[model samples]
Target: MNPEKAFKYDVLINAEDLCDREFEQQDFLKRAKAKKRTIVFAPRRYGKTSLIKNVVGNSFFNLSRNHLVLFFDLMDVQSMESIAKRLHHGITQALSRRFPVKTLLKNATDYLKGFSLQMDMDPVTGQPSLSMNVKGREVENEMTHLMAAIKTLSQKYPTLIILDEFHDITFVPEAEALFRGVLQELGESAVFILGSKRHLLTLMFQDARAPLFQYGDEIHLNPIALEDWLDYFRERMTPNKIIIGEEELKWILETLCDVPNAICEFGAWLLDNIPSGMTLSVGVIKQSLDLMVENKQSYAYMLQGYTEKELDLMTVIAKNKFTLEPHAESFLKLIRVSKSTVGKIVKKFMDRGLIEYELEKGYRLSDPLMGHYLATR
Candidate 1:
């Protein structure tokens, strides 16, 4: 294997580059085929985006050839107008990928009547790029039109609309109710997949009072099994003549809490820093982890946003690993906060993805690397 083609770690893993999620890929595709609306919940950096892209990418399920897969990320969307623009762009981009520029413009004109469409060539990829723009103060009406257009287009082409980080939609007033209404109107004409962080997504879909409650089948993406990771590492490393034993692999996985992105970062670090035919050692692993922590120095600044009490509580949680008894006398003494205050701060931390709770493990820092950083600092 070429050195350039060795183990790669990217923000977005390509379909073919995915490690192991065969079961999830199949399950997601199954739901899409049934036209069932689905909601996926996962921790940050747990490969939720990668799984969705891999399932829909041409090299995998090949849904793009026959189905119009419109993917939009609602992350940090502040207004209804911004959402309208994102929807328009996603629709046009998905159409362009499926149909030729000329045909897409001609066929989509009726469906996208209100929006101005422009065709441009991407300088880097030399591919046709479509841009959609609409101007108006009536953002809500524009959203309604977009949904109506989606319903009409779905009749011709089987459609799959993915809204990633969809919890951010809460920022815009009445966005959830609007979406629920549109979803009801579309019925089985389209399949929708909504993805978000576990904490926020759960509140949106599980709260009885929420408009989107029980709106879709829910799926949670868990960490890849250690056995699978070991096999994947061995296969990838053997080709490059790099040696890593199972014990060292397990240690790395445990250190990163089996987060796929973090593990891939470690692998990429090894491929770049270590020489071929050299066995991975504990010392080298420690260095890689330290380097990773150093690379994530920006994470520390996130602390500035919290209150002093919140910071103290977080520090306690990080140092202890997982606290089963957060309200215990000793825990409360450490944070110097009342029991009620501890509850509020813990809820806030959980809401922000700073901490997670397991039935057996209690509360722990969501990012284990952050735990190491907090411990040392």
Candidate 2:
């Protein structure tokens, strides 16, 4: 493979080349084949999306080549209409993948009756785009119809529906109940894979009072193992004569917090900027890391979005790495905030995906690079 295309940092990793996740892939496939619902919980940049794509692309549950896979990104969803529109488009795109435009229109005409579906040529790509419009008071009805269409399609084909960033559904009132109703209705006709950040996703499924409590098997994604990273690094770099030792590779993983995307970014950076001899020394590696941190300066504006106390509390957490006790007297003194204030700030940042809590590590910045940047800057 071309070195330029070998490291995929900004996009989904190719199915064949995706590293690690062997256990996850097999577990997910087994559940999917058995038509079990799954909730995937992970921090951002942990390759949740790539993992799902790989499973579907490679296995397809050993089903027909035309099995349908629908992906809906529910990020920042604010209203019922937004949910309805996303579902409508996701169903349409999934069908398009299986059938030609004419067949899609002909078949969907019956499957999607009563919904105003349109097929138009995209101005930018000149490709056909299919969409459904949800109007005024009919938003709820449209959402119901969309879910029904999913059930109908699943009965005829092996189907997988993925809702990415599903935690954003909380923005819409009673959305959880709405989804629970749909899940109860669907049964084994389809497999639903819901992905979201760890903390919020856990609460949604584990809190008994929540509507989606115990709805599916929950899988929490952790960092890729160091041995797997070593193998992947050697395979990708050795081909291009890029010389990086195992120790240096392990340091890169630790420095980047074992986030697959960031590690790939580092690899891509090395490929683009390594010396002509293709040797990566400690000084060069450190310089590369420094440059990566410097490039994150744009994220400094996020600090401005918080209040003074929030910023101070974040700084304390970032610098200290993790705080076992945010309300402890010494920790509170460092941030110069009351326990109540710290509690509110921690919750706010956690919700915003800036902070995360580990059972052993307590509270820390969700993105370690952001922590490093905050500590230095």
Candidate 3:
């Protein structure tokens, strides 16, 4: 097998595996190690998860010996039970990493008061893991107990917990309140690192009445710049004897809106297609992009649910490529919709997660490629 095949240009879960975002990594490291609460948010696919993991991993190495790091991914959690299970899993994972299995097993009950812990060994790896259950019967009871457990654990050890895709908690009323209350109760001893999709995340922190309002310092993750992409690609391609020119690299970045995931995926595609000892060119880039669009028929399928006005507005959005004033006379005229109709359409788009609007930034489509699909298809 070719060793280069192991290289990934996909979703990165660890910081050590990523090539850029040095600024974000350092900022998070400093704040988190200081035990300051921080919230790291970005649009989907902007590599927020990888950044947090990198910072968390670094903290374990650099922070005071008494501190423990815990990561809970709330992406797949839907109900109180599931969230409890994930928290249980996260706490166990952190404990397993820090203390011996025998020690954790002996002390788990004392460390986590409200929840019961059962220790077992992995048959293959022979590593000990724990399962948690509340002393009570219902999920709410379990969650209440879990919160108690977290409170107890936080007081005992200085802990940092990263809640990835935390915005999903909005779906469950009880879970959101319980989690927030716990964080409030725990105070400075437990620092939370939250990750979420930008739209929902915005609502959580920006809405004054929300439980997570003013929860922590908000750090927005933006696109990795062109020069960073160039440096990264040049280094990755060097081992394969392939080189991409400055202009060629710029075109790719421009085409992909400088999104790191797209840039990495497109670069990998180029590596697979370009012959060794050859310089990649504009034509090759266009051809690869065309192939990618052709394969993404699902983008078209996604538009099937939108009204004609919504689709027209999307096309205009793609063409303008900036925050849009959909209510403006020119935009309404171009889309041929009335002012009242435009407001409804914008809200509809926002509700469906296809678009977003802010006073400062106007309106934006969530995915850049989705705009490309609308403009061309």
Candidate 4:
């Protein structure tokens, strides 16, 4: 954690916890009361989970009478039932553990037990588990049962389900149907705050023909304000506050595009390496950037979901360090992609928010890390 960094590992520092999150408090209250669903889409390492955790931590919402926030991050979960039951149990468990749910959800525990619900945790860690039939029809039934269970809880208590790494649902169409159904059925009584790496949900809804075709307030979690990042770093400085040259730090942020996670990771490296930790010079910052660049594969993994040509296009954009939105035509020549296929790939990535296109500006990486990875990978 290095304690004194703009941000740190395992820390949830978002707008909600900044002494006053009142600016967005109204929207939070409305979402809580209206019970709408939000799909949060951002590039990798953007603190999607941290922001939601912060939202739940904010006393204005989490402690309110009409709200129960359940956050489930299925980053590593590969199966569906494990997701189902964990979601099922997480809602009720969070209700009981985090809040005064006895009054909000009567019977509290027994009412849930009465549902005849059954679930188990992953064998290794004993954390709640979920799995689905690989090639059968069981997923539909599981989804049905899972939704039925979540809805049952909503009947008793106002519930806000925050699903992180939500794009994982794309792996199973059955899961998508189940989620779409949840959005359809839960309506204004329940709030869904979802987080995903890409804008898959946007495309799913944006395409009028898709079943899950509707969307409500779509919030893009931006980089943690740079000032906040620096202030936190100044406070967290350990041993002795390590003074990083402003220009060097600015260069790092400019290179990284002010991403909180990367800032924390880079800061950690610098903090641990400094001999006296009194002050950091431009060379020290450059050294950290070198390490981050050398090990670019770590960040590049996030884009592994994209195809090879897609990677090629990204590589060009990364090398050039262009913006997210650019015309498809320019990319065709740069990546040496075939004219026929370039249009399709560009359209596909653009629609997915993987890249953006501006009339005058040409195309580029959606974020700095993605850009850098494309350049190096």
TM-score (C-alpha) between model 1 and the true structure: 0.87
Order of models, best TM-score first: 2, 1, 3, 4
Clash count per candidate: 0, 0, 0, 15
lDDT of 1 by residue, 1-377 (tens): 44434455557766567777888777777777677778887767788777775555333225456677777777778888888877887787778878888887787777776667789899999998988665444877678778777777766777776788788777689887777777776665535455545567777888898777888878777778878887778777777688988888889987777778778877877777778888988888888778777777577787778888887888888889889989999999987899999988887777666787754667888877787677666
Candidate with top TM-score is 2
- What TM value does model 3 have? 0.84
Q: Could you tell me which residue pairs clash in candidate 2?
A: none
Kindly provide the TM-score of model 2 when superposed on the true structure, using C-alpha atoms.
0.90
Estimate the TM-score for candidate 4: 0.71
**Position 267, candidate 4: lDDT:** 69
Better of 1 and 4 by lDDT: 1
Regions more than 4 Å wrong, model 3: 1-7, 61-66, 121-126, 208-212, 297-320, 332-362
What is residue 340's positional error in candidate 1, in angstroms? 4.1
In model 3, the Cα lDDT at residue 135 comes to 74
